[model samples]
Target: MNGTWLTVLMAVPLVGAAVLAVLPRRIDGNLAKQVALGVSLVTLVLGAVLAFSFEPGGGYQFTVEVDWISAFGAHFALGLDGIGLALVLMTVILAPVVILASWNDADPVDAAVAPGRSPRWSTHSFFAWVLALEGLAIGVFAATDVFLFYVLFEATLIPIYFLIGGFGGPERAKAALKFLIYSLAGGLIMLASVVGLYVVSADSSFGPTYLLSELQQVDIATDVGRWLFLGFFIAFAIKAPMFPVHTWLPDAAAQGTPGTSVLLVSILDKIGTFGMIRFCLTLFPEASEWATPVVVVLALISIVYGALMAIGQDNIPRLIAFTSVSHFGFIVLGIFVMNSYGGSGATLYMFNHGLSTAALFLVTGYLIKRRGSAQISDFGGVEKVAPILAGILLFAGLSSLGLPGLSPFVSEFLVIVGSWQYAIWVAVIAVTGIIWAALYILLMYQRTMTGPTRPEVAGMSDLKVREIVALAPVLVLILGLGLFPKPLLDVINPAVEDTLVFVDGASVEPVATAVDDATAEEGDN
Candidate 1:
C-alpha cells in the first residue's frame, strides 16, 4: 500500500474526473461539485497519510518505477522527497478549496438563463478539467524521471488552458492564448534541453538514461553544460514567471476565475522553483553556481519591480498576481543562495505562499461575486457589512506581506538571514520589498475595507457557511505554521542539507555568533 501511494495519489483525481465526465447529462451542478470535492478531500487525506508515514531523514520515500518506454529509458517513475512531499500536499489541499470556491462558477441554470449567456460549456466539463489538473499537477511533483517530469509539466497547460478559456472572465480568450503561447514556447525550449540531456547521456559512460538520479551522476564538459543549464533555467524562470517574463501572470489572473487563478499561481507555477532546486542545482552544480550572479540580480529586480507594480494596480485580482511576483523573488533568491536556511526556507515559502495566495484569491472572488466588480475603486467600507470576510482578507493580506506570526514571515526571515551570509548587500536590497509589501497591502485594505460605506456596498452580505468552510483550513494553516513551523522545518531541513551537499554549498551558521566571533578576534588582535 505504501509503495503504491504515489500512484493512488495521482490516479484518484483522474478517476474522479472520468466519473464526472461520464455522468448523466442532466446531473445537478451541485452533485458534480460534491463528487469533485469528495475526490479532492480523499486525495488530501492520502497526502496527509503519506506525510505521516514518510521517514523524515530519508532522501526519497515511496519510490516506484516501471519501465514505460524501454528504448527511451522513460519510466513510470514516482517518488517523494521532503520538498516534493510538501508540494504534493499543497496541490491536494488546494484542490477541494478550489472546488468549493468555484462551486457556482459553472451553474447550468445561470448559463442558460443569464443575460447574454453562452450555453456551450457544461458544468460537468469544468469540474472535470479541475480534477484533471489536480491529477496532472500531482504527477508533475512526483515524477522522478526527467522525461516524465517534462511530459507532465507540459500536459498541465491543457486543462488550465481550458479552465481559463472556457470558464474565465471577459478577456479569457486573450489571456488563455497568451498563457498557452508563453508556456508552449518555454516547453519547446525545455524539450530541446531534454533531448540534449538524452544525447549527453548516450555519449557518457552512463548511456541513454533520463532518470534524474542517474543523470546527476553523469558528468559533462563545462561549455556544453552551461548551454543545457540555460535551456532548462529559462523555461523554469518563465514559469516561475520571474521579472521579464511575468507580464502574462497579471493578465491571466485578472481574466481567470479566482479558483482558476489560485491553481495557476499556487500549484502550477511552483513547478518552476521546484525544478530549479530538484534538477538544475542537483544536476549541473557548477553551472548553477555560474548562473547565480545574474540570477540573484534578476531576483532582486523581481522583488522590487513586482511590489511596485502590485502597489499601483486598481484591479484586485491583478494586484494579487503582482504580489506573487514579488514573493516569488524571495523564493528564487533563497534557492540560489545555496545554503540550508535559504534552501529550506525557499521550499517552505512555496507551500506558505500557496495557502496565502489561495486565501486572497478565494476571498476576493467571494467579494467580486457579491459586488459584481473586481476593481478596487468600486469597493469601500466592506468591513462594516462583511466583517468576517474583511477580517479574513486582512489576515490573508498580512500573511502576504510577511507579517509576524504568519507563515510567510518565518520563510521570509530565513531567506534574508541565509542570503545575508551569502552576500550582505543582496539581503539588504531584498529587505526593501517588505516595505513595499506593507504599502500595497495596507493601501488595498484601507481603500477597500476601511473607508466610508459606498452606496453599492452597503447591503452586501458577509461570508456564508460554505465560504467560511472553504477558507478556514487555509487560515488555520497560515496561523499554525506561522506560530510553530518546527514540524515542517524538521521535514524540510534534511532535504535542504542534502541539496547543499550536492551543490557543494555551505550550511547555515548562526549569524549573531559569526559576527561575535569576528569582532572578538579583531579585539584580540
Candidate 2:
C-alpha cells in the first residue's frame, strides 16, 4: 500500500506476469495474446490514473514512501516529477503496442526450438516478462530512493538480456551474452561508486546513504566526485550504448524478434540517458561540470561514427541499430550540457525517440515476417501495397530526421539551443550530427520503401487490422507530441530546472538562472 499510486502503475505489470504464470498451459495463442493484452490495458489504465493525478504544478504528487530497509535508509520511495511522469507514461504506451504488433507473428526462436511448444506459453512468457520489465522500468524512473532506484535500474537488464538471447534470431546467444557482459560490467562498476558515495559520507556521523537526495548533500572533494561520477556515467553510457561500448546493441537488435528489439532499444536503452539525468546530475554536479568536455567529445564521435556505420548496412535491422548509436550520442550531448534546456530536451527526446524508433522497428518487423528476411534489398514499393504501414514509416522516419513539427525536432532544438550558452563550439560540432540524421534516415527510406517491388515483396499483404491497431498509438503520439508538446514540456521543465540548480554554487548564479529561465520559456511552448 505504498500510497505512491505510481507504484500501482508499476506493479500491475508484475501482477499480470504472475497471473500469466498460472494460466492454463493449454490456452490458445489468441487467448494468450488476449490475456497479455488485458494486462497491458490494465497497466495502461492504472498508468493513466497515476498520470491524471499528476499536478503539473503540484510537485511530486502520488508519492509513496515507506521503510524498506532501515539500516540502508532506503525507503520504498517512488514519485513523479514531470520528466519522470513522461518516461513512465511513454513506457506504458510502448508495451501494448509492441505486444499487439507481434501478436499473430510467430515467435521466431520459439518456433525453431520447440515446434511442439504451445504458442500460448511462448506468448504468455513473453508478455509476462515484458510486464515484469515494464514494472521494473517504471520503478527505475519513479523510485526516489537511490538504493531502490539502483535495484530497479539493475533489475531491468536481466529480463531484456534474456528476451534477446532466449528468443531472438541466429546469433541470439552471442548477442544476449554480449549485452549481459557489458551491462553487468557497467552496473558492477556503478555499484562501487554507489558504495563509495556512502562510505564517503560516513564521517558525517550519519555515515553514507544511497538515497540520492541524501548523497547530494554529502559533498565530496572535487577530484573524488569526478572519479565517482565516471563510474555512474560509464555505466549509463554503456546503457546509452554510446560509442565503442555501443557495439552490443546492433547485434542484439538484429538478432532479437521485433518485439524484443522494441523493448530493448526503445524503453530499456533509455535507462542509460535517464540515469545520466537523475543520478549523475543530481549526485555529482561538480563532476558533471568537469566531465562536460570529455562527454561532448565522445558524443560527437558516436554521432559521426554511428551515422557513418549506418550508411553501410545492408541489414535493415542493423542499420536501425547504427542510427540508435548516433541518436543516443545526441541524448548524451543534451545531458552534459548542464542546462535546463539541454536536460529537459534530452528527457523529452527519450520519449520521442522511443515511440518513433519502436514504430520503425515494429513496421520493419512486419515486413521481415512477410518477406522472411530483414534485408533492405528485400523491400521496395512497400507503400503501394501497404500505404498505412508505409505512411507510419514515413512519419516516423521524418521525425527521426528531426523534421519540423515532429517530436525529435523540438527536443533537439532545445538541446542545441540550451547548450549554446555554455558550450558554443561543442554545440557547433554536434550540429553536424543533426545534418547526418537527415541524410541517413532519408537514404534508408528511399532505399527500402520506394523503387519497384522485389520479387519477394510484390505479393505481400498489407497490414492486418491488429497490426494497424498496433501502429496507431505510436503514430498518434509522434504527431501528438510534435504538434502539442506544451503540456509535456510544462511538466518536464520544472523538474529539469530543479536538476540544473546546483548546491551552494551561487557565484555562478546569474548564468545558470538565465539558462534556467530560458528553458522555462522554451518549455512553455
Candidate 3:
C-alpha cells in the first residue's frame, strides 16, 4: 500500500472524472459537485497520510517504476520528495476549494446569449474537467521520468482550456485560444530539448534514457548543454509568464472564473519554476550557472515591471494576475541564486504563494459576484456593506504585500536573505519590489474598500457559510505558516540542500553576524 500510494492518489480524481463523464443527464449539477468534492477530499486525506508517513529527509518516497518504452528508456515512474509532496498536497487541498468556489458557475448566468457563445456548461462536465485536471496536475508534480512529466505537462492544458473557454466571460474564446497557443508553443520547444536529451544519453556509455536520475549522469559538451538548457528554460519562462511573455495571463485570469484563475495561476504555473529547479538546474548544472546572470536580470525586471503594471490596473482579477508575475520573480531569483537559503525560500514560496493567491482570486470573485462588475471603480465602501468580506480582502491583500505576520512575508524574507548571500546588489534591487507591492495592494484596498459606498454596492451581502468554508482552510494555513514555519521549513530545507548539491555543491556563508555588527556600529555612533 505504501508503494502504491502515489498511484492511488493520482487515480482517485481520474476515476471520479470518468464516473462523471458517463453519468446520466438527469443527474443534477449539485450531485456532480458533491461527488467531485468527495473525491478531492479523499485525495487530500490520502496525501496527508503520505505526508505523515514520510521521513523528512527522504529523497523520494513511494516510488513506483514500470517499463513503458524500453528502447527510449522511459518509464511510468512516480515519486515524491519533500518538494513534490508539498506541491501534491497543495493541489489536492485546492481542488475541493475550487469546486466550492465555482459552485454558482455551473449554471448559465445569461441564457439568452446565442448558442455558440453561451457561457454556461453542464455542472457534471465542468466538475469532470476540474477533477481530471486535479489528477493530471498531481501527476506532473510527482513524475520522475522526463517524458512522463512532459506528457502530464501538455495534458493539463486541455482541461484548463475548457474550464476557461466554456465557463468564463464573453471574451473566453480568445483568451482560451491565446493560452493554448502560448502553452503549445512552449511545450513543443521543450519536446525538442527532450529529444536532444535522449540523443545525448544514447551517445554516452549510459545509453538512451528519459529517467531523470539516469539522464543526470550523461554529460554533454558545454555548447550543446547550453542550447538544451535554453530549450527547457524558455518553455518554463513562458509558462512562468515572466515579463514580456506574461501578457496572456492578465487576459486569461481576468476573463476566467475565479476558480479557473486559481487553478491556472496558483497551481499550474508553478510547474514552470518547479521545472527550472528539478530539471534545468539538476540536469544541466553548468548551463544553469552560465545562464544565471541573464536570468537574474530578467527576474528583476519582472518584479519591478509587474508591480508597476499591477498598480495601474482597474480590473481586480487582472491586477491580481500581475502581482503574481512579481511574486514569481522573487521565486525565480531564489532558485537561480543556487544557494541553500535561496533554493529553500523559492520552494517554500511556491507553496505559500499558491495559498495566498487562491484566497485573493476567490475573495475577488465574491466581491465581483456581489457588485456585478469586475472594475475597481465599481467597488467603494465595500467594508461598510460587508465588513467580514472586507476584512478577508484586507488580510489577503496584506499577505500579498508580505506583511510581517503572514506566510508570504516569511518566504519573501528568506528569498531576500538567500539572494543576498549570492549577490547583495540583486537582493537590494529585489527589495524595491516590496515597496511597489505595498503601493499596489494598499492602494487597491483603499480605493475598493474604504471610499463612500457606491450606489450599486449598497445592497450587497456578506460571505455565505459555504464561501467561508472554502476560505477557512487557506486562511488557517496563511496564519499557521506565518507563526510557525519551522515544520515546513524542516521538510523543505533538506530537499533544497540536496538540489543545491546537485546544481553547484557550494556552501552558503553566514551573513547574520555581519549584519548584526553593522547594526551595532550604527547604534554606537
Which wins on lDDT, candidate 1 or candidate 3? Answer: 1
Cα lDDT of model 1 by residue, 48-116, tens digit: 999999887698889998888877778888999889989999999999999998898876445434332
Candidates ranked by lDDT: 1, 3, 2
In model 1, the Cα lDDT at residue 309 comes to: 95
lDDT of every predicted structure (CA atoms) = 0.90, 0.80, 0.89
Please state the error at residue 4 of candidate 3 in Å.
Answer: 0.7
How much RMSD separates candidate 2 from the native structure? 3.6
Model 3 RMSD, rounded to 1 decimal: 3.1
Q: For each predicted model, how many residue pairs clash, with residues at least 3 apart or on different chains?
A: 0, 2, 0
Tens-digit lDDT string for candidate 2 (1-525) = 235467678888888878876777677657767878888888888888877777775666677877787766667888788878898999999999987887754443455643422233266677777778988998998888888888888899878876776567767788889989999999999998877776687766556466666676786888888889999999999998898899889999998878888998899999899888888887888888777888888988998899889888989889888989988988888877776677777888898999889988998888777777788866788777777777777887888878888888888887787668556887798788778878777887887788886777778887888888889899888888898887788788777777777622312222235657889999999
TM-scores for every candidate against the unseen true structure: 0.95, 0.92, 0.95
In angstroms, the error of model 2 at 473 is 1.0
